[model samples]
Target chain A: MNITLKQAEKIIAVAKEKSIEIDTKMNIAVVDAGANLVAFARMDGAWLGSLDISIKKAKTARYFDMNTGIIGELSQPGGPLFNIEHSNNGLITFPGGVPIKNAAGEIIGAIGVSGSSVENDHTVAEAGALAI
Target chain B: MNITLKQAEKIIAVAKEKSIEIDTKMNIAVVDAGANLVAFARMDGAWLGSLDISIKKAKTARYFDMNTGIIGELSQPGGPLFNIEHSNNGLITFPGGVPIKNAAGEIIGAIGVSGSSVENDHTVAEAGALAI
Candidate 1:
């Protein structure tokens, strides 16, 4: 199923709450099952540079069906997925991207966060995805 | 000021209503002032190929602050902007893209619509932008 605007807002709201909790502004993005952007938000003071990164992270997670941090680990210089990130016209494999699943355990979409450290980004992304 | 998720949803809703009035399915995209994606929707049965085009159209409109149809006219051979479509890594220099302005007349975002005739796409895009 595609992500409705309502669901997308829910994800963004959770991301915002998590960002506030961590005291870091963030750029949050949500993409549909087809990896098309569904919703996005750039918190005040969020880094402009990371806006597109948030979108790409969600795309990367959807494209591979895994968290970007895990993808980063697998894409290391001689690893199995070496150079895989380059395949999708550039991927942010470090962290902060997570696939979103429905109650049936089907992947419905994905959430991506940026404008913070990799660890914090991942945490925010996780909060959003789980809120779905 | 950025285009929040709430505003994006309002644009999408108006576009959907216009698409129905015109008897066509459509892919709609919205982007903030910085030309980054804010929200996107592909109505059921919309053409798959026009998905990314809708996003790019919004970006094109935001980049030049003009409707894509006007850009298309200027990009015609022998025109001042002939070949300009190829300048921004490929732009949709046709109809269906419009800049979105706030109540104060400040451009805050843009809307793009596709998956129908050029005329109908432009009509739908206009409806969305005006809804803002």
Candidate 2:
């Protein structure tokens, strides 16, 4: 199942409500199960940094069907195949990223965000997920 | 502050405790403030797909000062500057990525992961962070 446009909308709405006075800029990304782009957005005044990150998070979610944070640890030395972390396109492995799941508990897609405090970033994404 | 070798080691330890019998291979990435690679590792049997994504997520965390998940949302259309989502490095924009924060709450670096399920990836990363 693919992420519906409605779900995306709810995410946005929640973000708006949760946004703080930091006037933080954000980069958001949505991808399908195949790890392909479905929709993307960047807030005004958002940093140029989000460009690469948002996409990576979506790809991680799609490819692994898990959050990037967990992937980050397993990629470490003596963890598993630590060498593989640097082997490819150089995706990230950290927290502040989550997957988008449907009612059936199957991960249909994912969403990632950046450009604020880590706590705030997680809060916004969490809000989006809770909204959905 | 850069992520020390010891911190990377801790992240790996937490992952080992959290990993399940899914035999999930993981790709982990660590980066400094400039978004340059500090350390990278990929577990054996890990999917080849993580190479690019792990790097991108690190860059995202470094550049955005937040997590990849938050950046994902701002990349959407009608959100802010969605067009920029596709620009530069073709990085990902989704969850499963996070920034590494020091005790002062300042973002010193970041970590990103891929492979296995999204939840598992997040769990492992979270475990790493908590361990630190």
Candidate 3:
């Protein structure tokens, strides 16, 4: 139901540890049980565009309770209506987003990171999840 | 990254199979490589509130490359700024979202669903992810 501070630290630490010489800036977001925002972080020099996209990714995960990458597949030919990105609203459909669960496997919140390649983004996210 | 139509169909099929007597309506979203909308669907009686949340979740995933649930934690005390939900721009942070990855482990896109309880939303999203 709540996003603990401990989890956030873990995500940051993991990102720093895994970060390579790329010195890539990171943008992270956390959401609550109701799919609301709980916390957010943007590393210095991170892309400004990544800020909004990062937060949106977390919302996608919390709202859907699934991985954003999977959502991408559903938007293809013969998929659903395929109208997530162009909804006129602030909805975005992409990868690099994930969810967080408690010991009981209940989804309490989520995490999203940007400012890197999709693979790097996913790696950092996985590290954060495992840290928790 | 690329999300295929086959994956979307699988998600829908699995959701129908696992649905209980709740007769809950479902809203599904899919995104593409650029974190843009590709496909989307809403069940007959689904809640309208879920639509924006669902797509935002997908975008959050793509932007952050992590789960939305984890993002929630960083927004708490001493965490990140915790401003994702409150950002002037439209960014959602919640649960019931997921991501789709390619064989190379590249983040292709994401998926999000609404119109049910958090648990139900997650279940349906999970089913869709697994279908791929």
Top candidate (lDDT): 1
The candidate 2 chain B region of ten consecutive residues with least summed lDDT is B81-90
Candidate 2 Cα outliers beyond 4 Å, as residue runs = A21-23, A81-83, B1-132
Off by over 4 Å in 3: A20-23, A86-88, B1-132
lDDT of each candidate versus the true structure: 0.88, 0.65, 0.66
Scored by lDDT, model 1 comes in at 0.88
Candidate 3 accuracy as lDDT: 0.66
Task: Report DockQ per prediction, comma-separated.
Answer: 0.32, 0.08, 0.04
Give candidate 2's error at residue B79 in angstroms. 45
CA error at residue B53 for candidate 3, angstroms:
7.6
| Worst window of 10 by summed lDDT in candidate 1 chain B | B36-45
Report the candidate with higher DockQ, 2 versus 3: 2
Q: What digit string (tens of lDDT, one per residue) describes model 1 on residues A1-132?
A: 777657877888899899999999898988889987766777766888888899899999999899999999998998999988777778989899999998889998899999999999999999999996
Candidate with better DockQ, 1 vs 2: 1
lDDT at A19, model 2:
58
